[model samples]
Target: MTNKKMRVVTCPLTPNQLHDAQLDLPKNAKAQAKLLAYFETTEEDFVPLKQLREELGVSGQAIQKLVDNGMLQFAEKKVNRDPYAGREFERTEPLALSKEQQAANDEILLAAKEGRPETFLLHGVTGSGKTEIYLQSIAEVLQKGKEAIVLVPEISLTPQMVERFKSRFGDAVAVLHSALSHGEKYDEWRKIERKEAQVVVGARSAIFAPFENLGLIIIDEEHEATYKQEDNPRYHARDVAIWRAKRHHCPVVLGSATPSLESYARATKNVYKLLELKARINQQEMPEVHIIDMREELRSENRTEFSRTLLEKIKERLERNEQTVLLLNKRGYASFVMCRDCGYVVECPNCDISLTYHQATRKMKCHYCGHEERVPEKCPSCESEHIRYFGTGTQKVEESLAKLIPEARVIRMDVDTTRQKGAHEKLLTRFQNGEADILLGTQMIAKGLDFPNITLVGVLNADTMLFLPDFRSAERTFQLLTQVSGRAGRHVLPGEVVVQSYSPEHYSIEYAKMHDYHGFYKHEMLMRHKGAYPPFYFLTLINVSHEEERKVIQTIQDMASFLRTKLGPDSIILGPVPSTISRIKNKYRYQCMIKYKKEPTLKNELKSLLEHYQKEQAKGLTISIDVEPYVLM
Candidate 1:
């Protein structure tokens, strides 16, 4: 009766875990000699006590005082996914590459000696190391013994990509994320089903890492709309690491720096294989990007959140003590509330919009159904004490940088300051040890933050995700202002990025203030080819949902009339409409979409519209389907 996702936890090794094992586990006697090498192995080695207290960096009250002194027991067992056989990895010397990263590592080492599957598109440019060509192409696929999968786009990029792949593959890196715990993701999915890790750094479900010699698959930031997965098994970790690198024949790569215009139109139609790092690591200088105009700082200094050219570059990086990151693509503490005598606003009765205001939980929330409350001294439909708030976030730029720079010090890093579990590597290791002079956040500190005394970044509000009615909101506001202006200075100082914008002539903020990703991918691929969107039409959507708003418009108008007779007229379709926040926690949505560029029975008509809504989900209805959907809401 208990195969509830294969449980675990069982062991025996007491006498006070072997007499306080060299002073309460002096570096876990190799995780208690792999917990007595799982009782001389077999029963497929029982582990999951939250993966042996996260591989013995102990404490769930020191493993419940070693299971109340008898030294552990309690199992729905099957655990021992062992591998860190007492850490000893050495092979270091890689970093020399840069002659266009050695001609993009000689065309990915001639497509990994032509073993078959290939799909490159690196297009690197944010500090151009692209994690040193993904740790020298996963150290040439761990020198031919194979296995590799990188993935990344956020579990706050799993602690700096698992501390640079466990400082270059020590204990052969294995991490999967939903921030672990499902017994540490079933012990890193049984260390790649017991091959015991040959490098798997995670996030985006490490593209299902149970590799069978999968020689390589990288995807770092690959134009991240959080690498797609928006729910269910919605996949798209870069199309599931190019379908598990074509069933493990090998090479996938994808890395990026603002690259997604459908992977730069499938790497200019060769169907992927375009490298181009084009300078940063040592060829430094891609910063100096100004553009301020907050509508002339709200018409000449009536000012609205800094823009005297970002307070003269945050007062010259706080008198050269250098370090500043600002960016505010929304995060509560403003950007909502409102009334000022019956114009009234304050939304989110279950989510259409506007609620925000969180100033360290003074509450108002509902950044789409989180639904908190309390901050309304009037105006709940106009009892009008003139309530107001309106725009700026990251807790109103950390309380307007402590009331206009009272000797700065900030830190922030959003989602309400890192909700626990190594809070985004402890606020990015205290803003990389300078102990914060200013690092405000949101947009998850906008991509691969490498802080070498972070000279200056200050974006504040570059069209907070450029007015999203979402056609990839101007490619996520030009990839969040070119990855938060490639986190300034990046190494040997020389940086600068102001931005501000009310709409400083928006060609996605003038192609992200001239760091122009191929002029914002040719003006957003001619506005996604005159708004048909995606690399020339391929979206899907569907949605539906109910709690009975006319049965969510008669189940999305009978699935858009059964997807226009199982899709035809060369596709198109569009709406059953009402979605963008059409009732959230209470359901009521609607959608449809389709778009298409040749469907070929669109995945068996979206698996027969999810098995006809699994029998109309017992009459209340629901549905979801997204496919290539980086948000339609």
Candidate 2:
């Protein structure tokens, strides 16, 4: 008390005067002030500098400068806290790498040591030691007393990837993803913020992990659209990673066999350094792609769900004791049940789309909305018994395969089958153990699986996404085809891909068959330039949903009008019309799209509109704002 009184009298203002000033403040403000004053006098019970900085919204440099100027002092000896406090991560030994991996590692280390933030696009083909390169880069950063953040797409939530990281980095690694519980995520976040974890790994959100001394950022599957969150703060993990790396003066590595057009453009323009790993780690050759024209099948009346060529290939793989993967983008038993006599399709009452037939449930269900109805005995339109299922889905494909192979075991992996946790891994494990001869699934089976025995890959309906309305549809189709094709032929045996498409000559399909990214990009970029799509112009999609269709449309129209009035002539607004599907999950949907040319403040303006709309819109209606939405549908 004597020392406190002496110090108070020597200050510019007396303790009594400060107390008087605090007395008239709000309760929370007064409490905060009192806590600060107590900490100054009671050094034995003071908070850490890091905690103080966080609480006061101050920067580390600012706090250090304050201490250097004699305005602040440490209350106790600094103690290191646990970075991975209250988090669980699997621990394992480092993976043994081949010569190719070693070379890649050395190159990355040399780039980092030179203090030049290298933007290396590690175009390592699948099974070409890309993960090893990632580990090597992380090790280099760790040795330099810095941190690394690895961003993987959501589909890579497999135990294999998790185990690999845990074994290599042990306690220094912290994972951040939507899969973690809220408390666990908070603890892991704190660990990273406190500098207890040197390496951070997770899906898209891991890009925001607060690593104090971030030195390296690794973006695996950089071409994945999932990296770009469709909702608010619609940030792309790859883009954000590059931005953060620049901020920290660190190196960024984007690894992918099929890199995004934007990334490819940057690398081509010399904004990013391109590092190509053309061959597989063991020099495995790329899969031989065969185009099975469905047009020919339809003409020959050989379209019994499975094309003859595809069936023959599957049988050959089965006889050879090799595994087979069949990809069908659709998920239900049939796309729709229609009345041939009346020309009526079984449609969802709530949405402007047909209901898909689910054989397991014997019900017609809406893929967009959860609307369901029992399969009708007769046509609901004309009461005629002429209803027939049209189009094929994964369920129909699975059914056909079971009947065709008979002796071979088949497992279907899709949203309907793997809705439960651990089901995805269970299916993959079964297939890997040879318990299933044929693994039929949607896009999930197309990624991150390194099965050497999978000598045959079948893409049913390869043109499904080619005719999509989005400008990036071609790019997406090429990426999916290439990625899925890369999953095969990782071992000694050559692999083959059979693509069944009506439009075999389509640029996307043709480029995919050739595994030609440059060709695809050049062709797609031309279309984008004509249409004024992304990487050329920024886009913001405003979605308004409500139970009442008219109200939703009116609100969106009002928003579009407001934006038009506020924005300059350089900005263009479109929509205030029904969405592609019109309705989803019982809510009528309307959308407004805004396109800006070099407008950095576009996002801010959109955010402000969202905030204002949240307050002005009726209570029953809901509004969702998506910046740079991937799909219009």
Candidate 3:
């Protein structure tokens, strides 16, 4: 909330006020029911009745019923941008960049000054002062009286990124993300629409900020799959930004420690101007990465969750009063629960996925559909008292850490803990302020967190993503490990990383351990070339879903047949195959993949196929087409 003040009559009238006949109240039952549902929802103390009606699609009489009843009352609604709003920034200035950073900054500044529509790939190593270049380039954009848009991949990164941008630009920056309340988002959006905010910062959708003269667009962590929207419109923010930059005659800088293969290949071919930040700020050495083979650790001792080396590192960080970041990458107490005797795994009835065991609530929950059930003492299938939890998650890791090291003050951050609004900022602030000895979380904590005291980084399961059946699995594993490892030794104090993995000798893990991105890129490109994956061929995945398995199968098969005929024999058409998790929320899914080089009418043909199924869509059928999908499964 950034607005100043307004009389928002949101609170319901008191019983005494309702008794007063002077107070007009709605007599309609529908209005009363709408008012009842509105009050049931936990909302802020007050909201403008006009705004509430618009937001809820309720009639004025419906809103009046709640006010007429003892459910809502009138009060002044003050806008609050953040929980810690109105705090004074430190008036910090951008640091002098190293030679590589200066070159990158100059190139971008030149582009902005010349008002040219250029796309540059800021291919920088982690901790290479890429943000400094961003700040400097944005400064140039502002100096030219033009707006800029910065897109981050996750909301978790927004707090820190916004802090840095706001410190430099003050009130000129406005943030927009899904994490913000409706009112909060509206205020920020208005700031941009009214030309009050010169710089717009947020995750993904910030690319669509309504700025007339956008001079520069920056996509930090551009390689993130989160940049791609999974739902309708299905726009990739990077691609959108590039398109917009062209429209506005601005520069779009794609910055990432590990650029995606497609982007890097384009850079190699001189399609994108490449700029590299080769060294860390102040030339601090990269953290020493120790890839501990979990197989050897298991052979020595049956400690499946944590290896001896990682445990020792955590202990050392605790003993020295230095902060540590432990990444589990998974949430809940256990990944999944199963019966030991019958080997019957608990599964979600609505989806083709297992239920994760949450220790706090003693509930088995599905990660896909939010289906939860009480953890039974006896197995429902086998009638045996051998039901047990398996696999390590963030919660389990946290419990083990606390039990093993009683003196350590550990803060656990995961989906469960951060489900509430402002929880991410609160936890990160507590950790950043030196209130917590160790920060443990999922991928949320992997990147964009810059705490100087965090000298130790431990990755619990580095090989989990490595086994995923996708072409980019190895690339993702390497990027994740490398990004998480970059979290350590961000400042003056030297740092180290302990990565526990069963596949210790895998190319991704080994390359990550050596901090060798170039070598890994080369190796991955070789595999991609041979496999006919991205950068070599364009891939489109067509998914057909329905309640009936037969319908889903028939739909995808028919679609695949049409694609094979329409696109001709040059294109490879694969599968009406069942999706990896074929059933989700009672919907059966089958997918067809098309790998093509270049087909002039491919997009129109696909659009036509989608249109053909529009009539059947009302009969519980869904056709989703993903072009250049992040993952096929």
Candidate 4:
């Protein structure tokens, strides 16, 4: 009657014993031999009794005869599902740590030994042995009879991270992420609740791991925007980790190459302990960066996506049998389809954005709303047959590489190419095994990639995210460039970087070229100060959406007016305007942004506003609130 137990028919005797036993054989020797042949080859310990009668053409009487002869039996067994049931990891010993890493580890261990709820901002360079410090800290935590939780930024990072942890901790590690099935997740969760798992490594949700004796929590790539849940029940894993650490009296470590402005600001203010790793392990030098201006290439009549300098570097790496990583920040075959005759473009019907043409599928897709349509032969507005695709994407770069350098092998990684389960790991494995010479990808390839042969790194278009409306665009651009640049020269071989940019003189690109995080931080802080943005003032975004534009505008206006009265006079309320890329899925969106240094009652007022719109929300109108919002659009 147990839900986890099932009745199955199993062979009680070995195949040789059954064959050797003297007995009166059935007259239908064919049926007897057929059933016996299955037992000889079947690998399963047991099969469902129903499958035996239905699939094997055997009746209950035949099975009962075997049971009576002590050859087979029906047993009820409990079902257990383990995600890593068949995988075996070789145990690894701890590597020698650098002096800076050892110093950081000592501070963390001191805090843990005293049961202090300290939050450490481990700001290390990309190749500065941050992960080794994390592992050593966890080793001490485990020795104290306490459990630990590690949160990675994305599922793409889990496979590599889990392998590292499992190789050290073995079966004591449990994985929890969206990629696992419901049953697998349940089993992992049960293992945690039952105190069977000592360490949990997974994506964001692993923060909720149920371990009563928790001692340490680690958030890798702590600055990643993916750590913030943008949807309803929104929460930042860092905040949650801090909250849980306070309850359990444990230390929480935030490890990143480029820490967020908020975290860095806090570290400067003495609110969080800061640890720095200035040099790469074993004295490996940082990659030498060269910024190539595309305008100069255009003047020279070289119109391909790759600048001459980048192309030469790629070819050099190819000839040496070293690897290369090409980052284009955008996906699809082309950014959009536009008509040369009328300046008209193909746009999605449901969203106020152009459709991206996917060369493999031969269809134009809307990145925001999942809308699709065929490419038009003639312009919709002018009825002219002069359609052309514009903008460089990963697919386009891949195509150009194949034609321009026919011998170069390229592997493309983007949302389009990595949609299937295990596709990310498979592609990365192929690249790591030296199956491909060049690794072409979008943002996912910007971090957590370590390969020894990758001596050359190229950024196809470094200005892709530099001009977004969001205030954090400059910070993000610098972080991405630095992260992708670190993929080269990580080991014994020296590394080089080629950055192709239209705005090569911009500070973000220049600082990234010099690998100067502090310079970019100081410059960006001034810009943020002038604009009254984050780390200076907190922001809350109130978004309203409706099919009717008028309704959305009116709703946002009312909310802004109501907030003006409820909040203090010092607060700045700016909005009642449409969002960038405003319309999505036929919904017209409007937002109100609230910026304040301190609004003691702001949370309560926002809750009251939601209560006032309870009826409006039920009738095709949607309202959402994001505090310390990552993306404004």
Candidate 5:
């Protein structure tokens, strides 16, 4: 619902009049009591009039009579709920940029000044002052009487990022994200709509900020998959930003240390202007990365989650009074529970996946469906009493750290610990204030964090995403490892990184150890080309799901048949097969994959398929189309 202009009513009576009115009590004791309550209890100068009448049980007539007698007075005033109402920032001035940063900033400023709708890929190494270029460019745009929209990954929108923008732009900056309350989002949106805020710093949705004179758009950490909305009305923020930039005749900046393959491909093809910042700011060295083979550790009779090298490094950091950031990328206690005696595993009845054991809750829970059950002593399937938890997670790592180094203060961050409002800020603040020796988390702590004292970074399981069914698993593993590695060695103190992986010799891990993005890109591009994957051929996934498995299959088959008859030989259509998970929340899923270089009629054909299945949808069938999905599963 649109938030219309709201008016507040305030008392204009003096203290003397209030005393006189209280001494001579009005006949409507309830209304008079509410008026006194507001005056005595609330520090707010005004209360919304509608709320006062409805919630405080104040009668309009009683208020009018009180106003007439000069015992009280009411004044209408506009009110807005400011999200950052009580926060104050120390203003910061622009910093002197290096030659590379200055050149990038100049290009961006020129584009904004000339109103050219150009897309520039700012491929800078981590800690290379990419944000400085963004700040200087936005300043130019704001000075030109235009607005800017800056998009950062939701997980990367830490207090540090928000503070830098807020300190620089002050009240002119508006933030939008899913973590904010609906009322707060509405007010922020209205602020932008009313031309009150000139710069919007938010997650993916901020691309659509209602700015009439938009000049510059920046997507930081542009390779992040979080920029894609997976649910209905699905869209990629990068695509939307470029679309809007063209409409407004402005420039869109895609800044990342590791750009997505599709985006980097476009840059290589001259579709986007490529700006490179190879060296780190202030001549700081990139973190020295060490890839430890877990297989060797196993052969040496070591069974701990941490490799010997990582544990030694952690202790070294602790002894030197430094900090460490550990990335696990998993959040629960264990990946699954299994019975060694019978080879039986506990699986979620609602979904086609095993239930994860959350040690804090002492229950096995489904990560996908929210189904929970008590950890059974005996295996439900085999009646075996040898049940055990396997695999590693953030919680498990935290527990291990406590046992290994009792004196090391660790702050564990994940979805569980950061569910509350301001939790992220509070935890990060504590770490920044030297209250914690180690910050352990999942992917959320992987990027956009700048902590000076953190000299050590560890990856407990670098192979977690290395072998997924998805084709981009290698690329994702490389990107994540590279990003997390960048977290250390960002300041005056030198930094080190320890990556533990079962597949230690994998090309992705080897390249990550060398901090070689170009190597990984070249190697991965060949794999993609050989497999006919993204950058070579665009992909579209058409999913059909229903309660009945047969019905789901039939619908996908029918759609596949229709597509084959309509499309030319150049377009390849694969599968009317079950999806990776197959069944989620008791609904069976079937998908058809479309790979084509040019199919002008594909969208219209897909729309017709949806139209044809309108009747089936009413009977519990669901169809979803993802043009360029981040996750195939």
Candidate 6:
């Protein structure tokens, strides 16, 4: 207080500026100058309490209190600006709906207002404008100042769905999918949390979007197996949507042409309200389907995967200047290689499954663990030179189509071809633009695609997934066949599907051919009841894996013992058994399956069992819990 004169201080340097300034000075000079500057900035006689606080890195609150006590005058409060503050988002007006769509909207709105969850089968065949109903419901939610979330199975389908949402909802819609950059995802999540977005559309993960007031949740293609997450949390997006709806005291709309057996069961039991949209918007009829028995082809050794009927249909479509789609559920060039004389099959070293021959790479690869090897010229067993590619795949089908119809431009869309960024859209666009006269691919081409010119669809092998070990195989096969068939006949002109299968009379294939969903459901339900599969009982799978086979088996055995002790003798324990593919990625796997009635404490018991296993496991043992796993393998 000797001379309390106000001292004038120059603008304080930022940390970066100070660092740059220190680089230009000699070592000693830099140290001395920094010390002098520090003292000069902190000296009581030269600086006020507020300025001293600023120099010493004190917060605004500390300086404010000092000022309130007459110990400081003023302080500078630093404010950081958000980087994404001025970023623009696309916005568009909602589309006008037709009378049918309006009626659907009113029905959904009525249910939503009553706090009731409605399950709409949307039995409308493909191209029925079911997506429009979803949009209408979203619009109503937005109007009520609440948020909406739309869930799709695959992110590959997100781009199209996002565009549709953006076209209707504009900037109010935000998309959250794995494809988004981390920063983009964070920004989108933040936007939703801030209540800036009224609609969130994405793949499975979008179900968790932190919307302030969720009014409705839509599960598109609700029957698709991709809705189930295979990893930790093991949550089904459809199930999560229902849970979230209850949490928010709102309604959830599950829109799917092929509803899952679980949802169908719930609807039939009066647990869920069932709404059906049985007609197409444009009044276009479902495609006619024909099954070509493969037994005749095998007897004749036709060698071609495509049947004669399918070939003739493709030729007709080509002649009419219409497009075609050829589906082979298998993706490699050949499903497996075998020795004719030794009865030896080429198998994967890392997995118990056989390797498929990939023609493009000339390599045999295990689809389960991605193990690969050069395609052998001779059989390892018996030294036989009779190794041959046995079964056909998508690539082989594409090659066959090219050889048969050279004039038609053919495009193959499968995991191998569409692995790169933007490739899926590129291939689809080419097909849509008529650059590709025939599109050939695996299961991907079967879902949610609308092409007007595709008058003919061919299933190279409809029986591939029909006889899988899982009980849901028939249901899945039916859904795939029905969906692939729906891709045709979307436009004004009639369309046709040719199915090539060994089991031509199988109920799944027959029902799909007739486009009879109820008939298929009834037959499949009989099988499910006979097998004691879902809707009748709950099943949980615990998979134990390790580099050592003995360790995995032992761990699973111990787990089964513990589960039996805790869950009592009433619970069924299937195995300490090797998985279908016993080894994957060099890890030996064993599984323990638990099936029980859907009791009130079933989930809790499962959770506790998993936790107990996690704590009891020794080194080198890992366990995964899958509640209602889609595939046992």
Q: Which candidate, 4 or 6, has the higher lDDT?
A: 4
**Global lDDT of each candidate:** 0.77, 0.78, 0.86, 0.90, 0.89, 0.78
Candidate 3 TM-score to native: 0.88
Mark the regions of model 3 whose C-alpha exceeds 4 Å error after superposition.
1-84
The candidate maximizing TM-score is 4
- What TM-score does prediction 2 earn? 0.79
- Which pairs of residues collide in model 3? 11-72, 11-73, 12-71, 12-72, 12-73, 13-72
Candidate 4: tens digits of C-alpha lDDT, residues 283-399: 899999999999999999999998888888899999999999999999999999999998999999999999999999999999899999999988999999999999988989999
Q: Whole-model lDDT, candidate 4? A: 0.90
Off by over 4 Å in 5: 1-71, 75-78, 156-158
How many clashing residue pairs are found in candidate 1? 5
Q: Stretches of candidate 2 above 4 Å error?
A: 1-107, 114-118, 170-172, 179-197, 565-570, 611-614
lDDT of 2 by residue, 168-267 (tens): 8887778776655565677777778778789888889888898768888898888888898876677778778878877887889998988987788888
Model 6 TM-score is: 0.82
Between prediction 2 and prediction 3, which has the larger lDDT? 3
Model 2 lDDT, full chain set: 0.78
- The model with the greatest lDDT is 4
TM-score of each: 0.32, 0.79, 0.88, 0.93, 0.91, 0.82
Candidate 1, 1-633: lDDT as tens digits: 111354566666544544544355446445554454443453544677676667656556655555565656666744343323344444466788778887887677667768668999888778888788778877876888987888788887678777777877777688877755566667767767878778888778778777788877888888887777789887778777887778877778888888888888988998888888878978888988888777777778555588776777787888978888888776767878788777878787765777777776687878656778888898878587879788777777677778888788888887767877668888898888888788888878878888788878888778866787888887878888888899888789888888877788888888788877897788788878898878998988888777778877976787788778877786788888898788887777878788889888788977886786787787767787877888888
1-633, model 6: which lDDT tens digit per residue? Answer: 121234332324454554554465466453334433554344333344445546666555643543454433443332212222354436655557666667777878887777666555444566778888888787877788888899878765776677678777777878887766566677787777777788988888989898768888888888998888888778888878888888887888777778989888888886777777777767788888999998998788886777788888888888898999888887888889999998899998877889999988899998887888997888897988998998888888778777987887899988899777557767887888889789998888888888789888888888889887788888889999998998897878898999999999999999999988899889888888887778887898989888987777777887788667767545678987888878888888889888888445766866776677665465656788888898798
Model 5 vs. true fold: TM = 0.91
Residue 582, candidate 6: Cα error in Å is 1.1
Q: Model 1 clash pairs? A: 45-79, 45-80, 46-79, 47-79, 335-391
